[model samples]
Target chain A: MRLLINKIFLALSILSAGVGLAFLAWILITLFMKGLSSFHFSLFLNDLIEGGLRNLIVGQMILAGLASLIGIPLGMTAGIYIQEYGQGRYAALIRDLSDIMMSAPSIVIGAFVYAIVVVPMGGTSGFAGAIALAIMMIPVVINTTDSMLSLVPRELREAGIALGASKYKVIIDIVIKAAKVGIMTGILLAFARIIGETAPLLFTSETSNYFSLNLGESFPSLTVSIYDLANEPEESSRDLAWAASFILTVLVLIINLTGRFITRNKK
Target chain B: MEKIFQKLSLSSATLVFVLLIGIFITLYSAAKPAIDEFGLHFIINPDWNKEIVVETPSLRADTVANDAEDDAIADEDDMILDEDDDEMLLDDEDDTVTKTIYGGLVPIVGTLLTTIIALTFALPIAMGIAVFLAEIAPKNISYVVGIAIELLAAIPSIIFGMWGLYYFAPIVADLVGGYQVSLLTAGLVLGVMILPFMAAITRDSMNTTPAVLKESAYALGATKFEVIKDIIFPYSKVGIIGSIILALGRALGETMAVAFLIGSIFVLPKAINDPTISIPVAMANNFGEASGLGESALFYLALILFIISFAVISLAKFYFLKKAK
Candidate 1:
């Protein structure tokens, strides 16, 4: 009876694992089928107004790029403080709070930005979307920076200080350099995360159909437009949404795998 | 330059601390108007955007007498009053008071119900997958399958929403006999979305169980199931629970995954398969057009969602997971 029970349990475990993998395979197959039917080379060449995705693709990159610019420095410094400079409960407190912030609702973050930035500006803009993405990115970047910096050997810092380098200089010149690959991978993953985000950009950037370079104006967002298009009653709009979704999934998965590959190579 | 760098770093660290409190305060103040108007009653009141007509003292007696004289006629008058309440409020001096009541009961209930459903559907499959990865699978198989599962987590959630609406919901509806877009379908899709996340973390927690303990159990002639039940599970229980709660927090705030599947209505569902709205779905659908109290009410929902998720994540990270660490 015990052996029989064990066999049953093992079978259940394998079945569940198969179930998990089957869904992934199913979703990928469906995406490929629907997305490829609508996919065309023109998608990269023309703006959405001209029936392609160039503007949205460009706008999303800009928003995520701007967020990385703001988030990387601030998050790295904060992470440095937590790992190197912080002494006791205060550092631990910040670490805990950052983790909590990392999990805070993205839509609530959207609402918060809408309340502060969008309300003050009197309209949605690319800047608001970037800020929301930055807020999301900061905690993730901090998490990566904190963990990567922790992995740096203590002797490296000690050696730098012994060479008469000041504390900040030692950290900048040695500690960060030592952990560069891991931090880069973390940033890549964080970028991958925010680029695929739809909820935070739903209201903040509030996707535009036309190409616009002005950060102060409504910006095109691939994810938000996908949501809008998917919900429309027209079949053509949904086909476009599926095509966009396919493109997005491809980008996110490639970036994610690249980050993982870098880490694996380093290890 | 050194002093400037230290100060800059310190302030940036301080900025993270400030940002959390700032979100709380900002949400509070944005939601203040609705808070003052509805108070805690907003949570329990089921009537969302309902108009209540308050008759003047002189007319109250007449309506009461009419109510006693003819119940059907009074019901008709009430319907007409509701239809004309807006125009009457605008034109009247002080004869009648029209109050539009916005309550959160339906969406709040819907949110809790969907989350419960998600947790129920996900827990077993996640546990089974975690166990398979941690114990049953060979190292090569485990590594490849593990990466596949993590890739599932990397898919954008909006794709999940769209796929659930088209391909998944129909099969579900056919199986369960309900509307294509419904609470059951939304919750199940949410389960599918969170399954890989929950499995990945749980597998990590299970892997933390020392190999020596498992080897000892096996040497004692214990079956694999016995070893897992007696050794690894007992060792990693807290970490596993923490991972589950963390996944719970993620499920709670998910907007797009639930938005397309939840049917986006304010009615309280009487059955598991009924169409309903969740808080995030409500805010996502209505925030664009809502104004004045309507907008404030959405902010109120946002504030509630933020607070609930905040507390849940903190409990997971600081309490259960802290112990595991």
Candidate 2:
């Protein structure tokens, strides 16, 4: 009876994990099956279809790219300050707030951008969207930076100090070099997250139907366009939504896999 | 030089505070027009017309005409004055809009309801998996299972939303009843979305239960089930709860999946099976249609969502911090 119970418990766990994997498999399969059906070179080259995602892909890359550039530096600096500089009440407050912001809903960030950037600047623009995405990216990068820096043995920092290196030099030369891969992973993950975000971009980046590279103009992203198409009245729009979603899924999977590979390789 | 570096660090730390303040200032200014018109009532009520009167002269004229009609129908002069007073009351209704600061109660309620339902379905299965992974499963199978569960966390929300829309919603609608889009479908999909988070966290937490404790239970001739119930669970309760809270936070903030499945009706629903819009869904639903006051209303909705999620996240952080300490 005891052996039977243990077997039953083990079987249930396998089944539970299997169920989770099945869901993941289903998502990938569905995307590939539908997305591949509409996949074409023209889909990528075209500007945008009324309720399509051509412009959205370009816009997402630009916005997400710009956000990472801004976020990575600030986050690294803040992380260095927290991990290397002595912890004080102020540092504690900043760290706590960073965590809070990290967990804040992406849409709230959108609303925040809407209030601060979009409204004052007078419309939805890619610049505003990038700033909003950057805000979302900051906490993640900061956390990663701090964690990575802390993993550098204290002896290494002390050795640098003994060599008469400046604090900034020590951070730049020894600490950062040590944690480069981890920091890169963090940045990549942040990029993945920002790209996947549809809610925040929905308001700050006004949905556009066509492709335009002008930063001041409104633009749609792949996620937002997928959302728009999915909700539209047309069957073709729905198919386009599936195609966009499939492409997005592929992009996210590649990023995740790449991040995992880099981390594993570093280890 | 040391003082300068310290000062620079202080300023940098202060800069983070400045960014947070910047966020607040922006939210305040964007919300100001609606707040100015609606006042504190914006927190209590759901009036989206706070600035429509200002934006459209025709709307103001219509309001005045409606008030005049109410005034003419009254019998007493005092009552007519009272009817004018009632327009004042109607103006006070505008105060409700002011007070309604995006009365996120409905959306907050919807988010909590959906999260709770998802948790109810996810926890047992997750715990079962965690237990098997940590204690019961063969090493080879456990490795495969673990990798598979972790991969689930990699799937983006958009894919989840798409799949939920086309595939899961239909199956759920079929199994439960008709093809109605409901909270149940949302919760079900969200459960799937969060299963990996719950399972992974639970497995890690349960793994921390010292082998000695389980061994002691087993040494007493306790069955595997008995050891799990009495030894493993009690030890990992706080961590398990922490994991659940973290998963709950994710559920609260999930946008696309819930938006696709929940059939985004704005009003509060009567049952789990009924269509209801969550706060995140409210933001998504309004993002496309919002213009003018409708836009501000959406931002306000977004603000409300941020606050709700902020509260949940803070709580989870606090719990995890306490557990870590």
The prediction achieving the highest lDDT against the true structure is 1
- Models 1 onward score TM values of 0.94, 0.85
Stretches > 4 Å off in candidate 1: B55-94
Model 1, span A73-108: residue lDDT tens:
999999998998888998888899999999998999
lDDT of 1 by residue, B1-325 (tens): 8898888888889999999999999999999998877778789877788876656556776776564443334334455676777787777647765557688999999998999999998999999999999999999999998998988898999998899999999999999997998999999999989999999999999999999999999999999999999999999999999999999999999999999999999999988889999999998889889889999999999999998999999999988999998
Residue A59 lDDT in candidate 2: 85
Query: Which portions of model 2 show Cα errors greater than 4 Å?
Result: A1-8, A50-54, B1-13, B32-105, B139-141, B211-223, B287-300
Alpha carbon lDDT of each predicted model: 0.91, 0.74
Give a tens-digit lDDT track for model 2, residues B30-66: 6666554444544554323322212123345555557
lDDT of 2 at B316: 70
Candidate 2, residue B49: the lDDT equals 32
